[model samples]
Target chain A: MGGSTDSGSQNRLGRRLLTERVSGYWLQGAGYFAIVLFALIVLALLYQSLPLLSEYSLVQMLTSSNWDPAQNQFGFLPAIVGTVYVTALTMIMGTPIAILAAIYIAEYAEGRTKTLVSSFIDVLAAIPSVIFGLVALIVVVPFVGDYLAPAVGSSATGLGIFTVSLVMAIVVTPFMISLSVESLEALPDELRESSLGVGATKWETIRIVLLRAAGPGIFSAVLLGFGRVFGATIVPAMLIGGQTHLPSSPFATGQTLPTLIVNDFGELMSLPLTQSALIFVGLMLIVVVWLFNFSAMILRQRLQQRWQF
Target chain B: MDRYTEQRLFGLLARGAAALVVAVMVLVISVTIYRGGRVFLMDPTIVITPPGSRYMLEGDGGFLHAVLGSIFIVGPATIISAVLAVSTAIYLQSDYSSERFSDTVNMFLNVLWGTPPIVYGVFVLTVIIAIGARTSMFFGIVAIAIFQYPIMTRYTDEALRSAPDSVKEATYGLGATRFETALMTARAALPGVIAGIVMGFARGIGDAATVLFTAGRSTNMPAGPFDGATTLPVLIFDQAMSFNAEVRSHAYAASFILIIAVLGLILVSKLLAGRYARYAPGGRHS
Candidate 1:
């Protein structure tokens, strides 16, 4: 460190350094801000949810499987089940198409075709989920009921696990495609060249080498997409056919945590227990999202470490 | 002959699939436009005339107001978010390291980037409403900023990290201070950062759930931070659920407008990214 001789100069230098250290304190304050914001959110949710938890113990809330807000029987098992069911279904519905689209865009398609497809994906990403809900409610539900349901063995009820998953797939597909394309783009040119040089077909090289190398990244994308579909409120709110108790059938009406909060909170504002019950649901959702994030980070670390090729 | 046959078959399959994806996307746009355009075109009742005239009357101003409200809400939020995000990124990158601090920052940003916006909306709404900041556009803007910051942070980090290390070292080796190098050397490479900020704006505008809770549902133009106002998403939500047929048409129109603005931003970013990738060999594209 540079040294100063005069005591006054030393004090001036010390103050200057102190000021510099404190400069843009807001930047360092951001971590504190994030933690506080998250804590406040959790606490507020707990306050809101206290009513329902007090009215019914946590055990009953977990085991009852019935959601009768009016009757004061607030079992969330069905909603939890439904939320997970739709998320998994959406992943199943969307992943293959996303992977294929990413492969086509990043690996195979060239020129105007690539640009056009890429633009389409971007547009899809830009379109809001509520718009998707409107479209699904108006067009998709009818189409599903009139054609898809009869073709299969189920009838379209306008709200069901299937419709929710379908809408969720549309929302999630672009995310998955975008992420996979990123990882695909990250692959070095030489890896592709060497695979080609070894007399391997393009499909073989993509499946065996590219896909394997991109595994962790692709997994991260899927998990990210899952996080999105899990938290989405409008689609499930608008289209999920059954709204009363937990949905027993795929076609049965159901409520996820967000919809439950919106639905019950409006009427139960005066009831602390009711409000707290819903907040408890929100807390559950935060936990689910946190879990998804933790796994995705792990997967991302693995991908960054393993995929130097 | 074999190679030609192989090319022909694979080429046909590829062309077919490409055509399908294109067709599906076009169908989505065309449908949205058709639904949206009905507000301007087919509805004779929607035509506005002078109040005293016998000719006609104006369509309800719901869609118009909604569009304006969205702009008002997202615009300031985007600016504030961009400043904070870029500053933070620059501060971090000015002392580039594979250290714990940088990693912590990256993880926080990544989680923010990946967490659903709906969650943020609910979270912010919980705080704002709890603190009696409800019914204020100020809270709404803050909510949007929260959502936008994560994206900007990631983008700025990537952009600065990708800025040629040689230029930075050259500046530093000449005895230039860190701030000077960042401002003179790094700030010049801010086009990519700016593009990222625009992209964040696009996301903020398209967001419905977040703004819905933070920004209260008011029909009037926002008077100030304290004034209650409804944004495009909230207006659309109200219309979509409304029993009125006329309002439904307006909702469609508003959705179309929001979608166009968002898609436009994304396309611009893509173009900027592609151009940067071609020209700036050292910079990474989002």
Candidate 2:
């Protein structure tokens, strides 16, 4: 092999390699910023929450319903249970409608209808959560207090777990539908055509082929929607009546984690343990959200391996 | 029932479900427009005029302060977030990081994106307290920037990933540096990048949770980035909770404007993405 000892070419090659290495390192550094921010946030929440933990056992925080901060009671049991109830109810109410609507959009609806429905979903998703709370306060609260609650063999003041879940269902429906539609649309057309060619009807093709293919994506969509409802602040804060008790029923008023922090935030920041309690609430949200995300990731991976669709 | 009829029934049910969702959206939007529209028609001045003394008590003046505050805090936050998000997205490519590393980074991003905005509020509030600083537009911007970063990055990353790989290859084949190659590929994904920025801006301006404790509501006009200022969402939140008829009406009015702005931005993002798609390779769309 003939080697060219040209100094200029060698210098240029060296410079190019140097540029490559430097830029790669710089880009990786930028990419790591997300991790850095995540660590800082978790650390900050944990560190600030230490004071409250020092005062009360973790079990007491999770089990007791006594939340009178005036008496130094800071039980988080109600908030945890309320969040679970609201989120579960919201998913139960919203998911079926969203998934079916998404199926219509991705499989049945065509041309103008598809575009219009998608645009509606996007706009709905983009609406501020505060407005959702505002509208619910004005409209649904009165209706529930006057009619819906009385008809259900229960008396109510309208703001309760039920109302919060209903409004939150509406708030999260569009988001879930948007994601579900995206997943369904991502399936290869061949999956549909092959099923159809094999004597499968349109619905049959979608049920067997497209749905199976897009299962993990749709699952994650629901998971993400769950996260949205779990962390929702304004709707529950305004409509859940802020009773701060363990929810007696769907018609009974109570506070979730986010609403607890929001309702308690204004004047309570002055008290040190109270401040830690609130920050601890924030920490709980972060921890739970992380759990959801990690579980979603792992489950998606496992589903992908199993489905092989 | 036979399979054909059963399929037909299922199709009808799905269509009904779709109709229900559509009906819900329409009901919400129309309700908003009806309630908030009347306020605007009665007094367009409310959106334009600044708050006077006893704005919440008397409902005598407009919410110009919130309008300006939203602009001041979110505008700069969007710009900063766009740069960081795009860079982070570009760096997630094979040129900069391995697949495993990028995947880990993405998990972090997803968690951040999923974290409640209130947590960001709490974290930033803790910072403000630790630093002995008042709730101000400065911290508001910082909180919003942090909140928007992951959202924008995720969108930008998806856009870049979906770009035609041929464009990337040709750039590298032309002896371009990785940075230059990234710039070329980024331009190829320009429509999506711009859409991401617009979405982040919309989210930043529309969110109350991130700025609720950090921005601190005020009737006074914005003094500076360091001063406490209120945004439209925050104003609506306070107004709705004030339990006064007049204040509630203002909340409806303020929200009407906010909804219009957000919806308009969503439309603009769609139009811009569509328009710009035609200029990029393999990105053309109707």
Candidate 3:
């Protein structure tokens, strides 16, 4: 505002224009950095993982449960199932409470209670996943092994699919709750007003009107939470008990793909085939998360377009 | 089975769920603080003291190395990311770009944001292997910067998008260029930008998986950015997994410091964004 206007000469104005043009181009480059980084991640994983694909087909890697690194057995069926099992459990336990809490915040909570619960969720989000892992390792594992598992009449050490998913349920609830609160709050007040005016009760209006309107946003929130739990590493790594075999039950130990990479990549980096396999594991994770993220983004955009007045 | 009773029951359930979440969070924080506080209660200066030989085995020293290491790695990484993220957010505005372009790019950024931190670590480690370098603090910085970049950019972009169009129009009316307009808009969105930056710093400092392989662990103090370093989160992972009872307590103490730093940042972020919302256009005067 000051420089070019304050200057007296045509030369200074020309220089200012040049600088502005250059800065524009610079900002454009900055804008493209995300695209570039995304492409680089995909390309890097693809390049590293091409070899394993050549050696064994995708279905084979996905279907076979054997994972003997020493014997060149690189099946991922168990890990893939384990990942799904953990994610399903996380969602089942987390989504109900998250949606209910979100509904409470949007429909029922007074000012102070809403503010307190939202801040609590914010605090939970700020706590790192590794901290969750550490706490689960110390508290949940022993509780399951020493008490809960015994109560269920199962001999379990507690480091299993169930324990990891339980901890993951807690870890991912903040994300789902925050996003869900946004979706529910974004609905027009008239939507609620009309429902109540038509003689619908509060719960009935929320169930029949608001929740239906906010369905896309809530579903997308669930999808993003799925991605979060799907890609979870620390909790699974610390508490999965490092079992390579397929688990016989929820109480049995197993690893997710991310945990598989984390637990094995350090020692196996020197083995070319093993390194490729681990990178392939990473590729699978990226692919799955990308799919979830893509659909969630679409759902989010739909919700935005619908609500935009 | 009655309608009113059903409504009351659900309302109670929802309240219970909300209270349950709050209680779990309180319990986790209190347990860590209490357990971690015991060690620090015995030796209050351990936060500042460096570790010694057999630190993991005997818990002979403090976690100063990891504390310093986290600062050194995540501090500069966050600076780099803040610059890039702010500029990227500026460029994505309607003034400087098309709506379609912004939307598409935002989708990409969203996906990148959702990409796991471990993926970023693997990406950086792959780059390191391709370039023939060992794991070090420098690579750790690169990994975390990439991980934080999308997150910060998304927050800043949202902030800038919510900035009043009147401010931009005023700048243009005054003969300011697009870049100058963006600079002014950024100033108006300072609260959200600062909050995003603080959140990024907390994440980068707290993530262990991103730097697990990229930053090799070392007991001695990191000599330089290229040297191996163990961040507080990574140190906690190691100590928590250590078979020794003393080392496990060290995990608690280290987490105590890490939790305090992270939760304090979260609070600062919330307070800044909430208290300063009126600074923008159409809001109360300062």
* Candidate whose DockQ is highest: 3
Worst ten in a row by lDDT for model 3 chain B: B277-286
TM-score of chain B of each: 0.80, 0.96, 0.95
**Stronger candidate by TM-score (1 vs 2):** 2
Give the lowest summed-lDDT range of ten residues in model 1 chain A: A30-39
TM-score of chain B of 3: 0.95
Reference-based TM-score of each model: 0.86, 0.95, 0.95
Residue range A202-266, candidate 2, lDDT tens digits: 88887877877899999999999999999998788889988888888888998999999888887
Residue clash pairs of candidate 3: none
Docking class of 2: medium
Q: Across residues A43-91, which tens digit of lDDT does each residue of candidate 1 receive?
A: 7767766655656678877877877766677788878887878888898
Ranked by DockQ from best down, the candidates are 3, 2, 1
Which numbered prediction scores highest in TM-score against the true structure?
A: 3
Candidate 3 residues A1-309, lDDT tens each? 567656656786777688889999989999999999999999999998888889998887899999987778899988988898899989999999999988888889988878888878877887988888888877899998999888888889988988998999999988899899998998999999999999988899889888888988898888888888998888899998888778888888998898898878766667888988988888888998888887776777787677543
Backbone clash count, each prediction separately: 16, 0, 0
Model 2, residue A123: distance off in Å is 1.9
Write model 1 residue lDDT over B1-286, tens digit each, in one string. 5654664555455455445555656666677777877665654333222112211122344344456667778898999888778767776764633467777667666666766666676676657646756556877788888888888878777877777777777777986555556654445456677677877888788777777666776665567777776677776676777666766676676677767777778767767666655434355454
